[model samples]
Target: MSDHTPSPDQAPGAPHPRETVQLIGQDAAQQAFLTAYNSDRLHHGWLLTGPRGVGKATLAWRIAQFLLATPPSDDTGLFGAPPPPGTLDIDLDHPITHRIHAGAEPGLAAITRSVNDQGRLRNEIVVDDIRKLGRFFGLSSADGGRRVVIVDSADEMNVSAANALLKMLEEPPARTTLLLISHQPSRLLPTIRSRCRTLRLAPLDPDDMQAALAQTNTEVFGQTDHLAALAAGSVGNAVRLINLGGLELYAELIAILGTLPRLDRQRALKLAETAAQRGAAEKFDLLLSLIDIALSRLALTGATGAAPMPEAALNEAETLTRLSGSPRQARHWAEVAALITARTRHGQAVNLDPASLVLDTVFKIQEIAGHSR
Candidate 1:
């Protein structure tokens, strides 16, 4: 693949996972893979499963680098099989690292959603995408070295693609490993799931999220605790929040929510206009998601009788507490959130005016607030 070729596997506004040297806050997953490697129980088909932005792909790539660079345990050198390597931390200067970085690593293949005949990227991994790995297996097999293929993510594989992959898992080629990254493993064929050993990645907590964000070139501004809470432990989400001015937008949302039944009309309009602006499609999407988050938090606050801590935005606790004051109010907010979500989808489907849809959604929430009172 050309270095410039767009990859669906890459998170928006974040560096390619392969480019990330460190996998933050996933020590357990790392240790799991390492344990397998050392015990000589490394599965031919490894499933890297986790939520988005939780370093699954990074772990896969790290394993790929380790396998390709490290000699087989049986192949004792002059030093007689170094006592089973402890960590997957390969040196940056390793030749395999250089080749992998250059996208010229023959032993590794990173599969993502492929481009169609029309030059547009397809939404699902087709059979052809999975079959293409046959060539990778054949060509790399000649070297008699470990070959690794990463499908990020296997959940996006269509039925045909999934079945094709299942054949490989059932009868894998010698000295080859297939790493499948999946956000939702349940979507995979049961047979496919059965054949692989799963390495589950976890969401990064605030401190780890901070360290992970540092590895990226994304400039840090505003409170990271807020980012951490809003992102739900996903580094990918945090990076998106930062790049899209989501933190500030969320703060403004919290401030608006503080007004409750009588919302700050001018501020509301400004927000809607912001989302409706030409070339603001991504931001508009982010706004809808933030609204969903806000409603959810509100419902949880009322149900639990306490606001979620380290608030996603300043005064968010106050707003959520004020609006969702009782169990009845919480139930009402949940019902409202459902209705607004339905309207949001319908509005998108029909390509409704962004500003009108946003204003209408806000109005509905305001109605809920009034009813709750």
Candidate 2:
């Protein structure tokens, strides 16, 4: 299915998309939304929170599908949830289902970032968009029951846009449901967070990640165990890593780890420069994963090998592990890891240039490696 297209059962102006989202280990959360639909007790606003790429938007679309399936109330756009799975299977062949899939529902609406004339992300959901939302939801529900407006993510809203959204949260219209999808709830205004019933989505487990990766049918360079360790519970990141030449990068990283002891300053500088020239976020993530994998290898070697890792990677990994009695070199390597993480987070918040950040990390890592010698 096209990423932006509505599901076959969703229509425009409707609150829910017609798509069927596969809920993974989030039964309680799904049931809460389902219960709200069943009882017509749906809140005016809902906050969907979780780490990035763990299916927040997918869940929102599921709720949207449910809303579009039922007619609206006089002032509220609410719907009774369909019966239990055994009782009734929603027929996909219905005309209404197709309409919803086309995003033609009058009871549903969604606001998300769109590219502007300059071809860059608008960066914020604007007041104009919020104002339009107010106008749309204020109208009587065409189907005569409930109206829903889903902000695919409230986290992207700038200060003004957020304030405008806050106004609606302050005095939401009757019979209207608001679904705000957010990866980072802390970034949103506390007032906004306090006003809504929040449903948190948990990270996917390693098994789930493996299943997802298998479905993608891409080659994973490292072992599944190693990739899972580096993935840190993000299926989206794993998928990206697999598709974007990650296997090659992992192989190169392994080669580097094996050779770091004999690696020269000039060669390290070249590698650092190469890393820095790549986008900072991408390079840092790759480096982080590489470091983690190397550490694991070092630990394994120390457990079985007669000699520790020749004071090259072993010392760095020991310090990075933060164990007591960690050597000075290990601590230095750990410090470099910390710096990369901190800068990456900061760059995301302030929109710093990624290339520059990558370069900075490379130079620092080179210096650390030199010191280890």
Candidate 3:
């Protein structure tokens, strides 16, 4: 995705329009549809599954782009919603493109996390969002063609939300397409999984990441390789790293790792204090990034056989970093992160004591480290 979000003028429907994020490694997915189109086999519903930040939503939109504009007679005589994948050449400049991108296409509907009245964003796709799918797809296509509804990610739907969606799946509307995206498909109910054709999208390749970064025109990070590797194959993460000054933070953490051994207790505590002031979410991301940097450095150190930096000090830093990133610890970290974000959403409500939270997190890190050793 480009760090340069389209301006109101460039963006259709002006302000608050959905930005077009670059999608990577969808050739197989695209080909799957092509094969189906050629074979006259189209499923009514599809579940696109992959890790977070992958292009599930983007792919869903692409599919929508095809359905909204393609001629109705183009259906490959298929019984279900989707006719043939190759049947639609999705043009980004199409008039219907604007409608789909603006999320106003009558033939297409999208379910995603929406901001709540309290200003905090809803993490879960609610039941109401799913219920709308039926209404969106149940009616005949606006032009008497195919109708589509996309759940940006089915994984976020709670039990109620999932059930609401299940009803629509059981008795699908004719000439309707249901595209459900899932980051953690394993977490979704098997019944839901069984109802939809599953398409798994893998992480982007290094080449894909490079191409996307080039398109974004992000010159700030001259180290494309570093950024790509840091992104872990998600263009979203790559853009985030560039726009959020993540590179500088990672570099700082690298420096901290290099100097941890020689650092005195006062210095460590001072750094901790600064982190404390960052509040929970920032601190949590920092902690994860710090650990990631430490692990990378460890690999580098092991490979280069450089003069051993303070082993004990590096050990201590690694311990703290690991605990901060551990799954067991991540549970607690998430609670704090969620609370802090919720508070921030509520008028930047800063109720929790930053110092206390940091102290507790660090102490937990120490405990994890001790156990590991």
Tell me the tens digit of each residue's lDDT in model 2 across 204-305: 787777655554454565467645644556665666555554545655554454444444445444545545564445555565555545544434443443
**Window of ten residues with lowest summed lDDT in model 3:** 8-17
Model 1 TM-score? Answer: 0.94
Q: Which regions of candidate 3 fall more than 4 Å away from where they truly are?
A: 1-22, 73-89, 138-142, 260-373
Give lDDT tens digits, candidate 1, residues 225-330: 7988999999889888988889999998888888878889999999899889988888888899899999999999999999999899888888899899898888
Q: Model 1: residues >4 Å from true position, as ranges?
A: 1-6
Alpha carbon lDDT of residue 208, candidate 3? 82
The models' CA-based lDDT, in order, is 0.89, 0.60, 0.59
Scored by lDDT, model 3 comes in at 0.59
Candidate 3 per-residue lDDT, tens place, 1-373, comes to 1333322112112112134444557778867865764665667889988765556666777777776677554544557454434534566678888777665777777677655676556778788777766566555445577788878668888999999888888888777778888878898888889999887787788788776556566554366655655667766566666765566555544444344334334544554565555434555454455444444434343334331233323233453353344444444444444444343334224544544444443344344334432
Sorted by lDDT (best first), the order is 1, 2, 3
Q: What TM-score do all the candidates reach, one by one?
A: 0.94, 0.70, 0.70
Question: Between 1 and 3, whose TM-score is larger?
Answer: 1
TM-score of 2: 0.70
